[model samples]
Target: MSLVSALAIYFIIWWMVLFAILPIGVVTQEEAGEVTPGTESSAPGRPQLLKKALLTTLVAGVLFAGIYWLRVHSGLTLDDLPFKPPSAR
Candidate 1:
């Protein structure tokens, strides 16, 4: 892949991994028994966003590496998928 394409793929993968990781290890104010008067109980008591972000970056990097290998070394392409319509094939 070109530099732009590689960067774009990595960016997409990073965002996806971030979303997937966001709900993990969550602690709501209600769950922690520390719901403040003004805030909703459903709000997170300690989001630990920095840690999740770091983890997301690591996971996304590994996933992107696998995808890059499939695209480059394995010569896998969109047309090779089995679900394509007969006309397209």
Candidate 2:
């Protein structure tokens, strides 16, 4: 995999993991509308949903970067080697 391919894979994997569970970790309470667990007043009217989304994305991005590094060093990237078409064989 080249740099582009690695980046693509990382983003795909990261977002997949993030959204497979929940795009936003926030949840709505019966009266509060949207709140985190064990919290009250919903943090004084902040954008809880957006905050969760940003946090999830930030964490995913870091994880993706790590995976990209691992993939690049796993000896699977094709950058250092040349390839030939099947017909050339």
Candidate 3:
């Protein structure tokens, strides 16, 4: 893939991994028994966003590296997908 395409793919993967990582080790206000005034009980007591962001970056980098290796070295292409458009068929 081109540089822009590679970057776009990595961006998408990063967001996906971030969402997956966001809920890990979460402690809701209700769970912690420390709901702050005016905040929902369901809200996290401590979001730990910086930690999760770092974890997400690490996980996404590994996933992207695997994907990049497959794209460059595994000889895979669009043709490897199981489906085809009607026109192509």
Q: What is the TM-score of each candidate against the true structure?
A: 0.90, 0.44, 0.87
The digit string of per-residue lDDT tens for model 2 on 1-89 reads 68798668767876776675463444335345755667765454344656556666787778877766666666555565687656843
Off by over 4 Å in 3: 84-89
Query: How far is each candidate from the true structure, as Cα RMSD in Å?
Result: 2.5, 9.0, 2.5
Q: Pick the candidate with the highest TM-score.
A: 1
TM-score rank, highest first? 1, 3, 2
Candidate 3 TM-score over all chains jointly? 0.87
Candidate 2, which ten residues in sequence have the lowest lDDT sum? 23-32
Q: Assess each prediction's global lDDT (C-alpha) against the native.
A: 0.96, 0.63, 0.93
Clashing pairs in 2: 1-77
Candidate with better TM-score, 1 vs 3: 1
Q: Which portions of model 1 show Cα errors greater than 4 Å?
A: 84-89
Clashing pairs for model 3 are none
Q: List runs of model 2 lying over 4 Å from the truth.
A: 20-25, 31-47, 74-89
- Give the TM-score (vs. native) of candidate 2: 0.44
lDDT for model 3 comes to 0.93
> What does candidate 1's lDDT look like per residue over 5-36, in tens digits?
99999999999999999999999999999999
